[model samples]
Target: MGIESVLSEHRTFHPDQTFVDQANVSGMAHYEKLCVAANENYEQFWADLARELIVWKKPFTQTLNDSNAPFYKWFEDGELNVSYNCLDKHLNTQPNKVAIIFEADNGDVTKVTYKELYEKVCQFSNGLKTFNLDLGDRVVIYLPMGIEAVVAMLACARIGLTHSVVFGGFSAKSIQERIKDAQARLVITADIQFRGGKTLPLQAAVDEAFNLGGCESVIGTVVLKKSKDPIELDSKKIWWHDLIKNQSTKCDPVFVNAEHPLFLLYTSGSTGTPKGVQHSSAGYLLHAMNTMRWTFDIKENDVYWCTADVGWITGHTYVVYGPLAMGATQLIYEGIPTFPHAGRFWQMIEKHQVSIFYTAPTAIRSLIKASELNKESNP
Candidate 1:
């Protein structure tokens, strides 16, 4: 039997004419036109988008390579740096534009402009060079949702090192498995994470993972000090501030092949062993950019917010890559929805004037429940 619908509604809400006029996709006719164009010549369609959206070190001759069957490649002949596409390109146009708006759980706010972010990425990239990490070397990032996490990921991409960002909430055992699987050369994490009025030890987990053994590939750990209290450090540990202090903010971008592995993200291992999924440079960026523009109707002045951790795929695409690639300002929150108050998210949306908001359905449901509770209590 066919699956039956649990709920149905005939009501429909259309967008205001003002919004439709300014939207990227606009109306159904425009979308259908694009669909037709793409369906008519799919390879050329992707090629056109790749050329328009990406700044390539070397232009691609072929769009897709399917000679290998199940394992296919895209824009294999081209070369480009993911970091450059995200930050450097934006500098010429909107250097002073706010790239990241960080909202801490305690209600503090910090903003970083494009030029500032570029310099930080460059400095961190140079600092990573001091560690003697070479091309294709994997670095694992374990940090909270903040600017440093973005900087670390971009820095790794800038220097041609593959980065795997593990969610900050993952246990030490999970961290150990990812580190071993990725064979990470270095691990970057903060001293602590403040979330929902709780101080969680991030660095301690990395250390615990090391103590668990089997992470021999990792050479050192870069710790971003988030806590006020002093923490013990060994020769293998280095403070992030110290590493980038004296470094030059002029690290050159290392352009890699289109098919070069940009980063590795692992599955939750719900069914079996967690498998690492590798994403390439050009194709992934292209898709992310396109989706950001189409789905969010992203604009230059819009403050976009994706309420997802940087460790997840949504965060990787929307919070970090997609928005930046489009030169759109984004907001990153370092707290849960119900922290401090149930209306925290709504307050932020109004405070930041976020034009586009992307979140999971579970988050919406929680907000609804919170609203109901608040009303009952007030009544």
Candidate 2:
């Protein structure tokens, strides 16, 4: 029997469950239409999309720029602060809307509203400014999947500070290399990260990395205290609350060049150091938001879950930037799939009634091996 038939013989999905097959559909066909339509009457399409999504301080005369090296600039010469479009504008329309729903391994959960998130982001952004981290300065983030990490990132973007987020699981050497390559002036990390059944010391890794020769010795390492285990706190390391506690929640967003590098994500290398995959601010946001719209079929009320760490481009594009731009509810999961059991994902899905789920293909293969899909009670 074929695998499908064999699987059907042993089990099957619930009749009510919808099977979505968008793979066979030409992904490029729609984009081709967009490109053609965009080219035919570039001004109209560009203006419509721009007016719909972005907040323009000054309207643009040009729709696109082909002279750039990276080659795509949407709404060129248009003035729009990325953070303003993503956070502030959303606050006016949907201030009370739930933006992030965090699900932890310990079954604890929290939801953050756009208004609340905006305040936190502003305070964090202001706090970073107090450290003299101006625009173009790099902030290396070594944070696990959580709201704070997202806040730190948005705060950086708001102020035009380039952020380089390292996955929480990478080794000290790897972290050091990225920090060095970016020459980050500030490092943000948590005291302890809880994943699966293990407690990882994130701050310790940051400390070890700081010892290496990349980031300047004068760099500030801000530690968020999430766990209590008498972890050594250095003089150079300041508590998150202490830094941002008295800071103002109101900060002006800085407008940057359309082609200016927004964030640098280092790709994992096989034999040598990772290559930093840089993305421009305006174009990247537009592409990311557009992809999120069609690829996931996002709805305003949909509870979206992207099972990828912030370290990867998948997380940056799908989890944070894409959903946030679309004003969709995103779930930040802070643990491994096998933690406790493979049932964890299903539990979240059933609990949240998640409308759209996006995970890596590797995860699907793992699920096939574990036969968890068959283990579903409906099967």
Candidate 3:
């Protein structure tokens, strides 16, 4: 049986210290009533959630259609843009609020406000249009966890292009497979990927993938320079900064239907070929908003950190889409906990005052061991 099948254990974790004095913290009774209402009328529940959480260009007429049992269509007639919901909605109320706190592996830090993010997304969107690609064109993004990575994905969404993000650490064979599968005409990758005391030549891997992986559809490669050292450029390679420096930052967002594909992410299929999983734009946005608000108790003032690479779904959902859609600021650290020192993660929490943090169990075990070893070695 699949997990998450039994979400409710007839109890709640509401009214925590974060909301003890607020009227919104009416205790478990409120959640119980909601649960009962949702269970009794799922259609109305979903419709209400979408209406409240999502920013729609055109209101939806239908909530769901499960006629095709295996595949269900939701918010069938709604029109929206994921990028707009994430950055644009917060422009009026909190333009200066930090949307992303990017800390590189080398201890370099940068903050992107909502207004800044919106402009950058628009600029990148215009830059992407320079390729003369039409709506629904695919762009494969093989980038590390950085502000630029977020901007790239949002740019694709803003222009109605579907982006397939391959993990930065993925091998050339993997990148080639995903790019070929998506038939992407453009590829965006970084010059290098830094992890602790190591560096991976990411663009080299992308180039190798193109040579070895049947990339006849690829027109050009957009390279992001994470390192200060200038990388040699070729006819096929375009500097990411050069493309955006003179571009217009006032591009309009293309409104897509709710069921339109937002992004195509791959799953590591141990036995067979990795399969691309497609996510709908509005459905995904709403799910992320509701999940973060209820599960993590994400607040407007909270600073969240999910220790997962941007390539993975955890980071894609929490670090990029979910928190941003909720108008919440989050930390995007492009390094591991064991990097520099075992206490790096703790130091970051204190430095940024992170309220909620999520990580894999494996990371927890490794951190514990590293902490003990560091204490022994230092003492």
Off by over 4 Å in 3: 1-26, 375-379
Q: Candidate 2 lDDT, tens digit per residue, 1-379?
A: 6455434446656422233333312355766887888789976886677676666777667777768656667666776677777788898789999999998878799999989889999999989898887678888899988999898889889999989999999989898988888888889999889998788889888878777766673368888988866666677788898899989999999988766678999988766779988887877887788778766777777899999998889898888888998888888899987668777888889898898899987987786766765567546
- Model number with the top lDDT: 1
Q: State TM-scores per candidate.
A: 0.98, 0.86, 0.93
User: What root-mean-square deviation over C-alphas does model 3 reach?
Assistant: 3.6
Identify the superior model by lDDT, candidate 1 or candidate 2. Answer: 1
Please report the candidate that would top TM-score against the real structure.
Answer: 1
How does model 1 fare in lDDT?
0.95
Query: What is the TM-score ranking, best to worst?
Result: 1, 3, 2
- Score candidate 2 by TM-score against the native: 0.86
Per-residue lDDT of candidate 1, residues 1-379 (tens digit): 9999976768999999999999999999999999999999999999999999999999999999999989989999999999999999988899999999999989899999999999999999999998998899999999999999999999999999999999999999999999999999999999999999999999989989998999999999999999889787899999999999989988899999999999999998889989999999999999999999898899988999999999999999998999999999999999999998888999999999998889998888898999899999999
**Superposition error at 287 for model 3 (Å):** 0.5
